[model samples]
Target: MPGRYTLAKSVLSERKALHPSELERRDLPADAARAVRSLAAEISVTLDANAATAATLTDPALLHHIDTRYRELPATVHEAMRPPAGDTGVTIIGSIPLRDDELGRTPIDWQQAAAWAGHPERRCASYELDIVMLLLARCAGEPFGWQGQQAGRLVNNILPTPGKEHEQSGASSTTLLAPHTEDAFHPQRANLLMLGCLRNPDLVGTTVSSVRRVELDAAQRDQLSRPLLPILPDVSYGTDFPDAETPPIPTLSEVDGQHIFRFDPAYTPLDDADLDYRTAYARLTSELERVCIAAALEPGEVLLVDNDVVVHGRVPFSPRYDGTDRWLKRVNIRLPQRLRPAAEATETGYGQCVVAPFRTTLGIHT
Candidate 1:
């Protein structure tokens, strides 16, 4: 059988050969788009008046207020924004109005943004995008994030940094990001992943594959359902944490009668001794590649992915060290009831798991 790295490279090669034209695309209705823009504009004004920073904007109290306001949107707007039903496992909302000039000029220095208290201009753009994501997330479920990841920021900036662009991370530009579930190593992975594009001058496409689109036989399905896969944490979650690995969990499981997946090819290690598991894993990877779709999100466009049903990645693209590069803000969402006990304390605020010994290992006698 082929090694995991070989399978990953094969899939990436196939994905790279395809263009965005081959995949499906959807635009928001004009009326719905207008409503969203109007709402975003109103929220921007409020944020500006309050002198909201990223930290303040994501405050639990402020989030509640935003959620309440979103609920009050016209019923027609909500209806129009409803995602189409199918196996795609994604919804693309386009034509949102973002007044870049008013927000602020794009920052050229990533290190400066990291060092400064905050980038006022970039913060404004993030604030506007966050409102849109929060509205959409509330419609689907509650939005959340991890304190361990992305410095506990609710709105994560995904842009290529000078030193990190070639690495395999969200901030990596030249590397082909392997398709995986966001935070797959964590049991409290979000039910929905929201990405709002602030800028994409190069028009890079995001690759997505849905489990619903794969054809699995009973044997393959049963093999994958067994708790034989061990997933490791992504590097985004700083290295200071313990090296504990996840308890053996199935890559695929049925939740509420719907097929759900927990897979990260880069992090999930395969058991060399288990032939059935290895064969099933390879077959699943191939199927994902066969049905994969690419989406090139534009400025003012947001993509909502059903986290449980789909795996997503990014295609490699050249990034100019200049200010104009692909920039996106991401937020993870889950139903309030689905909040894990370990993360409860942080869930109401900037979501983070504060407790130590964070991972639960399987098969340990303890």
Candidate 2:
């Protein structure tokens, strides 16, 4: 088995270089940006140090106590969490206050924090951030994770690492991440994905594009709705997971009038014989990039993405690796009813789901 860096190097060696100027970029609307900044300021002042401390306590009893306390948050904070009316699939809550100095430098080693059993010392400010995410997610659905993904941690760290900066994984910092749904290979992928920034000194933006924003003709939409696409597991899932030869699945489906999408351009293999599917997929990816929105999240800010409706990726940025680079904490959420039967018992209380057997031969999970 090779190291993550080796795998990243191999992948990078085969790809052509990307020019930064060719990338797409967009900012939040002025009104929405202003509202979020103001709300974050107010929440910073309202949140007490005690709340931060309570967030770090993982005891079930203590977590319950903290949950009760957060439920009593001021009306203003609650209102800020709600997105403005419309069909936008991505929500940005910026300028939330974080005591970065107290949190110290970015971690050089990922294993310490990426483990299923979390690191206590790393929770200083991220713990409070996760509490906010948990509350927001509870309003819509339950948060979850996979035991085989990012060590099955509820709050996974997103940052650039030494050798993985060019890989398609979230740890990559210098590579263009092809837009895709989070863990699209799974049947029970998250309904919502939440990202909380801890340190983004360079102001790197996360790219997001929604299905609602992408214009498609009736024929194209119909083509995409057919079961003709095969999505592979993310590199982070390691190579040992099973079911790699599963049948092709639909990229888009309508359930109760709501559209659901599963896509990963980097991982999904193209079938030259299926001309219609290939053409439709190409158009879909192009539309997604055309309407892509880049949100530069700052410390204390959180971005909530409707994974079922939109695909997301990050812009390429150089990593200094000086322990002051970009850093974020991520979590996945799914409605309880959406939890698959096979993963229910294992993922219920704890977010750890059973990894499928597909693509287990890659030995990348290590």
Candidate 3:
């Protein structure tokens, strides 16, 4: 994995696609942003005094305490953040009242961020902002983390590493990140992805394409609905699930008359798929590109993507790595308490597990 990259495929057609300007009124209203800051400031004091440890931050009791404060937000904010319906499933919330100078420098990589909580002296200045993200995620679902990703931090930082600019993971910089599900391979993948901006000096775009916006013929749709391919782990999680009966992943499924899809071409084993299935997958990829739009976020803004209804990626940008480059904090959210029943006979846990210690507290069943 080199530090520089060029995308292997194009994510948009020759006709210029929509930019952040095209994404209408998803920004958080000024009044709501003020309310959010007041709430976060009050909670940050409580967390600093009592949280004591990072693990305690995820404790159910604390979460409940924090969640209760969500009522302080404007009712209009609640209505706006409702589970997306019949739309692009992409929401860009701006105006969170952040201080640019307090953000410090973006970490060189996620690995460095993993150690921030342990050493208070090296603590991230974005803890207040992180609390804002946690509060916002609760409006929709429970925020969660993986066993091996970013040392299992509930809120992970998205930044470019000098040595990982060409990888398929979030650390990539110069390479174009093709839109895909947050974690398509696993059945317990996030239903929603919350990306909050701390800084984006160069105005890097976070690309998003929803399944609802894609176009496909009847036959192609049918083929993809039936295609079952294994999307392996990306470089971020270097683990192998050696299960003899691992169920294959279907790129698309319809539930209650709505289409839901999980696609990650970079990790998918397309070579193992049948020619008909491969052809359909390629078509789906193109369709996603056709509808893909880039939401170039700035400081104090956040982007929430429906992981089930949309696939997301990052556009190529040069990272200075000088502490002032683009930086965003990310969180994985699980909505719909009990997950959809496994698509097959076996439990499709896929050998990976979540670190959501408060699942029971949140009324989520395994």
Candidate 4:
């Protein structure tokens, strides 16, 4: 399989350099810029440390620290939530003191929050909700504010069982989320993903990402472009399983002539035994996995994945079901309507209209 790449050899580094105007507009104060650079440096170091760790994605101690620290912030708690974003695509509102008085209601057992049937009451009644805010919050901005469903949706949770019937959506322990774009079903997609760690998993669950800068070659790019790969709707893509299944959507699309992958290695099914598309799928997967990099985040650590330029996943973890289980407060956000236009919002075939089916494929459908 051949590979395809842009003239830019260092894609990720190039994107990291914000245009002077972009920096000024985002109000990236000198101190904030310095802080972001420092954080990035620290992350780079952490990535190096992970080189010696197991590859399965279990890392609880780091998660524990993140949970403990974010629990310290109080002001950011609300009945609804939206990720806070800055020039760096993420912000930390540590230990937000979210007490019952803040929401005029009694707080429930947030430590083990059951999936709400519909709109669950805001968790702000009481308890310190460790929130990690992000600039690019959701695929499509929801109807209400950032606190609404579309932006601040919680995807992974600490399930009672690991990959069992009860815990199919998430692993009982710290498990790596496979690399894929967030809300691939939404047309108005967010270019970024903000992950906030609230409770540390008993084991490791580092975030793994594949950098396009290092992955994909010209031939691979051409292969990805050849066939309209089908994206089967996964039941895990939704909260409650839908009655009927939808048709398979394309796995790749050209956005303004740029190659973008709507990759879901788990859910994307291809019978590539045949020569044409099957071979292409095989090459696509290999290239994507080749340049994968992992980042294990500590508790209170907010990690942002550039969705457009990178594919992200998680490492496996051990779920102890202890009180201090791994928990993350997730908030998704996208640029306001005033920023990017709607045509740029979604891929032509896959993602639904902007903000229509609040949640994408919830469960893996057969």
Candidate with top lDDT is 3
Model 1 C-alpha lDDT per residue in residues 248-366, reported as the tens digit of each score: 66787764466668888776667442888788888999999888887778787878787878999998888787666777778777644432333222222212362211123211111
Per-residue alpha-carbon lDDT of model 4 for 274-302, expressed as tens digits? Answer: 46556666665565565544443444454
Whole-model Cα lDDT of every candidate shown, in order: 0.64, 0.60, 0.71, 0.37
Of 3 and 4, which scores higher on lDDT? 3
For all predictions, the C-alpha RMSD in Å is: 6.1, 8.9, 3.8, 14.5
Write candidate 2's Cα lDDT for 1-366 as tens digits.
123111211111112222123222223344544444343334433544343233332335433533454455444445545432235577665545456784566775456443312344454444545555555544445555567765544557787888887778898988877688998877667777888788888778787778888889988998987776456677787654333454567788766566778887766666422888778887887788777767677776777777878888887889997878888888676654432332212222222254221112211111
Q: List the candidates' TM-scores in order.
A: 0.80, 0.73, 0.87, 0.52
lDDT of 4 at 314: 52
Task: Give lDDT: candidate 3, residue 117.
Answer: 38
Q: Candidate 3's residue-wise lDDT over 213-308, tens digit each?
A: 778899888888874766666678874555453467678876556566878877766666788887888888887887777777778877878887
In candidate 4, how many Å is residue 68 off? 28
- For candidate 3, the 10 contiguous residues with the lowest summed lDDT are 1-10
TM-score of 2: 0.73
Name the candidate, 2 or 3, with the larger TM-score value.
3
Q: Residue 269, candidate 3: how far off, in angstroms?
A: 0.6
lDDT score for candidate 3 against the true structure: 0.71
